[model samples]
Every structure is written in C-alpha cells, then in structure tokens.
Target: MWRSGSDAGAIAIGVVVEVPTPGTAVKHPEALGADLWRTDEPDLDEPRTGIRLQEIRLTSQEGFLPRVVVKADLALSSASIITMPNGTVFPLDATQANAMERLWGLTTSQSLPALPGASEGQRKLMSHYRRERSNTLRLKKLAEVRARHGKCVCALCGIDDSSKYPRQLSERIFEVHHLLPLATAATPVRTTLDDLVVLCASCHRAVHATSAVEDNYAVLAGHLRGES
Candidate 1:
C-alpha cells in the first residue's frame, strides 16, 4: 500500500512511515513498473518486499506463531502468507513488528547487517550480510524486516502507527535516505543500515522543518534509538 507526494519541506531522514496499504504503487512500463504486481519473478522491482521474521524456528507463544513471518511494504503482496513446520500457514504480510530488535530477533543468531549502534568495524562486517535479494525471503524472514523498520519508523502527524500500536503496515511511499550516503566520501564509515531510514515524505519533511536544515540527510543522530 504505497502513496505519493514527497514532503516538500521540513523533513528529516526518510520515514521509518508505516503505512497499511494506503495507496497503490502506481504502474508504469519501464523497469519495475511493468512487473510491479508479480512476486517471485526474480526481478519485479515493485519494491522488493522485505519481511520481518520472529524466528524461522523459535517461540512457544500463542497467536500467529509459526516460527516465521514476513512484512512487506506492499499492501497486498503474497509474501505475507507464511508456512510453518506443521503445514499450518498464517497470512500476515500486512503485519508490523514490535521493534527493530524484534525483527532482528527473527534472524539466525549469527552476524547480520549492523544495527544503528554497531561499531565502525562491525558496520563493515555486517555490510557483508546486507544483501538486496529478490524473491528469496520466506515467511519468517519477511516478519523480521517489518519488526526492525517498525521500531525506528518516523513519527507521523495526527496519528502515528507506533509498534504494537497496530498489527501490520503496508509499504507506503517511504523514501530511502542514505545516512552513510551511497555516494560521497564525507559519509560516516560506521553508519549502519539502521542509520538510514525509510520514512514517509511528510515525516521526512517534518524532521527537516523541525531541525531547520537544508540537506536531505536524516541526521537522526539525536533521534530516539527506538520506536517514536
């Protein structure tokens, strides 16, 4: 559920806006536009849906617990349905996670992309794991992504979809603001993916307006390290 219109002013780093299939991701002919609706196409480009898993195989809690989860930004993608060890599947793609830690919690207890607090060396180490895959994640892993981003989602206006405040969030028009900027030499070396934010245009604008800066950098250095 994606939307349009970038917050033209007073923006901060990109949202961390958790939308619930607010709008359609608009269709086009070139590149991803043509295949926007097809998942597992190996290259749909309709925003490669990312999920946040609780645990590929963990947990004894009740309610939608199947050791796997997937949270894609798209409102109605197929990645939401998860298959469990018992052949029991739960459809929760539109679901949101408790927090970034909750998302990462789903990851194997192994090294992954660095958290916002990771050290410089650790950032580099995690970068090795920070991959941009298409048509690969399962139910559990999808849930993990949602949980992580849900933690740092930028505060929205009038109403905020705070973690646990809602169940699932569709991939709204959250922008990709690079804190360690994909380009430029002045970027921080220790910047982690968490350092970057996928914010709604309005939230991003509010951050800048609140801070009174000109650059698009999500200088969220001072923002809360957890959910807003």
Candidate 2:
C-alpha cells in the first residue's frame, strides 16, 4: 500500500479472513461489513471464497497532514502491525503468523480494479476499527503510566492496587480510564500520559454511572473527597 501513491496522507491496512458460510459450524464471527470480493472475477486463479485485504488511503491535495485517522482491529486476524513514517512500530499480535502467511499467498498476486473511494461497507468496518483503535491507544498510554509509577492506583480514590490485593489479583482488578472519550473528539487526537487515570473496576463503573460524570477524573476525585 505504501507504493500506491506519493500523495498518500493516511492509510488503513488490515488482513482479511473468510467468514463461515451458512450451515457451517461458526469459527470466527462474521467480519461484519468486510470488503468482500467476487470469486468469479478474472483476478482469481480459481473459484473459491475470497478474502481481500482492505486498504483506505487519503491522497489529500492539501499537503501533508500532521495526523490522519487510521483504524484497525487485530482481533479479526492477530497478525498485523502498524508502522508509522517516523519508523516507530506498533506490534499488535504475533499469534496469527501462519494464517497471515496463507492469506499473503492468496492475495499477493490478485490485482484489484481501481475505485474512486472507500465503499459503504468498507466505511462501516472502518468505523468499527476506529473505535477499537481508540481503546487500544488509550490502554497503551495507560501501560506507560504503570511502567513509570510501578503499579496501578485509583487516581480519584488514591487506593493503590498493591496495597489492597495480592500482586496477581491486584493487576487484574485495575482498569485504565480515559479522561476524554475518543467518540467526543472532533479530530484525530494523540493520547498522552496526562489524559489517562488508573481506577479500580468499582471506581471505573461509578465514574461512568451518570451522564454528568463527563469522563473527568478530577470531578470524580472531588466527589469522592466530599468536595464536589
């Protein structure tokens, strides 16, 4: 996809897997709104259920965009990575290596007829991937905090996991809460350390119990301290 065009400002890359046909025992859930292709197309070497990788690129004439919205879901096929222009690599999952190898052989030689933009189905799938990507990014930023501060602690209640539970149990109970949800953002926004807070499951649920909570950790903290 990198060699597609010089003006490529943004790109979405994902591996595709076949959905089970009707009356077949289900394995993977149907890739809801996958970019399906025709088996009878001249591009196929033989007639079979075909799965083509989906790619969406933004070839903006307005020049370089500092940030572009790209979405992905590793759960569909756990063999993918997103490498940025800066050389930073995000390794998603290594479990599906064999499946990816087979998919590569099937799709590498097939050429697709060029279309103007993303199809409606592709756009719908992109929306799903975007939400997943947003959550994953938030978790990554939260992991960084755990690495630096050394343990998970509720930012509002000041209850450190290490203080309340055994090591293994404590790790499982903590959750990362985003101060501002990605759905509310007007544009592509990068997550930062200051934007996430560690909260125990109970606190996390309480924070989101009402619409007025507003994803504001500070407000939740104030209420907990009887100051709100």
Candidate 3:
C-alpha cells in the first residue's frame, strides 16, 4: 500500500511492504534485508520496471506495516510503480485512487525475529524458528558437498571431520560459509549451492574474524599450514 495527499498529481511519499501473512508481526524488520524500489514505468505484465530511485531499505517501529525510510526525502514519481521484496510490484497513478493488486505473484516467506518483552518460552520459540531456517539451508549444502566428495572436509584447513571424530560429532565440525556475505548484500539475492563453501568451525571463525578473507581463502589456508 502507498500514501498520497489530495493533489492532482500526488507524489507517493511512502509505500508499505506488507508481511507475507498480513498482520503477521515482525519484531526486527532490519533482519529481513528487504529493499523497496520506485519505477516510473512499470510493466504490469512483467516483473521488470524502469527504476526511478535507488533501492531503499525498509524499517519498522515494532508495529503492523513497516514504513520506508530513506536518507534523503525521496518521493515516488506520478504514475510510478513500486517494487518490493518477494517479487511484489505495485503500479500507482497519482491522479487515480491508489488501487493495487499483487502482480507477478510469487510465494512469500517471512522470517521474524524474537518479539520484544517476550516470555522465555516465546524467546525459545523464535530462537528455534531462526535455527531451523538456517539449519535447513546448511544441511542441504552439506549434503551436496558430501555427495560429491564422500566426506565433509573444511575447504580452508582441509580437516576431514569423519576421520578425526565420531560419526555423530564429525558432522558438527563442518559449517557452510557464504562466499558473498549476506549481511553486505544491497538487495535480496538468490543463494545457490555454488555460493556456499564448507569450512571447519575453526576456519570459519577465522575467516569471519579477518577482513578480506573471503576473497582470498588461500591467505587463511596458508596461515593454517603455518606458512604465514
């Protein structure tokens, strides 16, 4: 939904990107990493739009609909289209009553953070929600690695967990690392198996601790081999 004033050519001051399930509460909108775009000419038939503004990140005030917050005061152009996460797009005419229907429909998935002032049980539930989401992806990546390599080994340190530890504990030693850090992404990106690498717990921690390590894994590998 978008907001406009009573003017012949009312500029859309802001647009709301609703949660997948309307009225679903989101405690941490920042964690979503959602981006909003304003387009002058939007192809209603296609997901593509002529972008008028740089993507702006969305933030909320612990409430129903998250609001758009931009560094500079940016307003949607007349007859503009707003592009939101999960492939949601809205075509808006400044002169007409703003009517929007979900075009180019796609499955919307939401991952919310723990609510504020929640009971211990509620906190645990949210914790599990996050863990399960993360583990699902991690386990899939690990499975693919094991399928091709026959064992889970660290890409950096070259530690074969199966050989060093018991079968049950061995799987816990390896972790999935993103070559491109999700936190640094400007927009939501589709992460494929190629974007992930397997790393031992120690090497994973070391890669995160050192700056510029992801680009040059050989540096960390050298350190692990006592060459650095």
Candidate 4:
C-alpha cells in the first residue's frame, strides 16, 4: 500500500570526498608519493572527511522535470576526487572541475571545514527528495505485481506481512522499493511495474540502510532464498 511519497525524483546533494587531514603539515603532492589512498586516513592534523554539496541549482523545464546542476567551482579542497552514493570514487572530470570553479566565483569566499564523523541524521542530509510516482501508478503497479506473484511478500526475504502480523496492521507493513538507486535519476521517468519490488518494513529498511543489499538486490534475494 502506498503510504507516502515516491523515490522517483530523489537527488543526491552531498557526497563524501577524501581530503588531507586538517592541521597536518602540508606535503607537496609529489612528495606524498604515488599512493594517494594512504593519505585518506586521519593523521595528526585533519580528522574529518569532506562532505561537499554537488547540486547547486534547479531549473524547471517545459515538458520535463526540473534540471539539477552541480556547482561549477568548489570552495573546499582543490582535490578533484568525489565519492558517490554507490561508493564509486573518481577524480572530477574537466567539465566538473570547470563547473566547480565557476560556482566558487559566484559564491562568497568561505572556508570549507572538514565534516564531523557521519551520524545517521547527518548522512540523510546528503539526499534531497523531489519527484515521485503518482498514487494511481503506484497502486496499479502493486496490483500487477501481486497478480504475477500470486501474493504480496517481501522480495528480499520472502516474508509475507499479511500472515505474520495482525490483519488490520499487516497490509500496511509492506512497502514497494525502487530497484534502481533513486539518486541516479537526474530527470523524471516513468517507473515501470518491473522497477519495483514488494518488501516488508524491516527488510526494506535493511536494503536501504546497508550497502550490501542496496548495491545488488538480486544477489541479496538469492542469498535469502538459499540459492547463493
């Protein structure tokens, strides 16, 4: 049953980027040698990881959803590295680098401080939810899935909430989860019936809160089914 909003338009705002530990004596990039990964840890100086905002502006388009754009310039470290929500880390490309510079020029000069260790709440701030599926589409998809599966059960764990909980509360405990990472969808698209899965509240939370399940839903489903 649809209870609230959809994940179709969620935008990733901030992403974690590795920076030299604050307060550490500055070493020439070449002097630090080829192994840049070793510098990611907190040493005597900077103890915090950098969380930088990426999407700086939103503009509505005719016949299309609003476009989300990243800042052209960065006020933080000059390092071009950025970590995405899917745990992919890569150096910013030339276009992104130039964009950051432009954004920096437009904003007030300010010091970019290292962010404190991530708390659950702080981590959540990295995402911004916008568009979503309509109630009509959601209900239709749910019906189609139930028709094909024969019943509503957790796609991850195969647990049926209707059988486990009280009749009045059981149906409300199940939710539909989007298969793809919502943050990657820069523009709105129709969410097909195949793009969603039924899951109990607990399993849905696990699939989202933990990287293992979120990264590969099929693998998790197979493991739960004892096939892997």
For every model shown, what is its TM-score relative to the native structure?
A: 0.22, 0.39, 0.42, 0.40
- Candidate 4, residue 178: how far the Cα is off, in Å: 1.4
lDDT of each: 0.33, 0.50, 0.50, 0.51
Q: 1-228, model 1: which lDDT tens digit per residue?
A: 111122111111122223332123422122232233445544333233222222221223212222222233233223323223223223342243322223334334545676687544221112111222222222223334458654434433322345334445534434434444333433214333454545555656655664334243334433333332
lDDT of 4 by residue, 1-228 (tens): 001122211123445655644544443222222232435643545444444445432222211111122312243134323223233244556665555444333334445466797433211112343444444545666677678777677777877756678878876777878787665666445566688777788878777776555666666676788888
10 residues in a row with least lDDT, candidate 4: 1-10
The TM-score measured for candidate 3 stands at 0.42
Cα error, candidate 3, residue 175 (Å) = 0.6
Query: On a 0 to 100 scale, what is the lDDT of residue 133 in model 4?
Result: 42
Error of 2 at 36 (Å): 27
Q: Show where candidate 4 strays beyond 4 Å.
A: 1-128, 211-216
Candidate 3, residue 51: the lDDT equals: 23
- List runs of model 1 lying over 4 Å from the truth: 1-145, 148-152, 155-170, 186-192, 205-228
Best candidate per TM-score, number?
3
**Whole-model alpha-carbon lDDT for candidate 3:** 0.50
Ranked candidates (lDDT, high to low): 4, 2, 3, 1
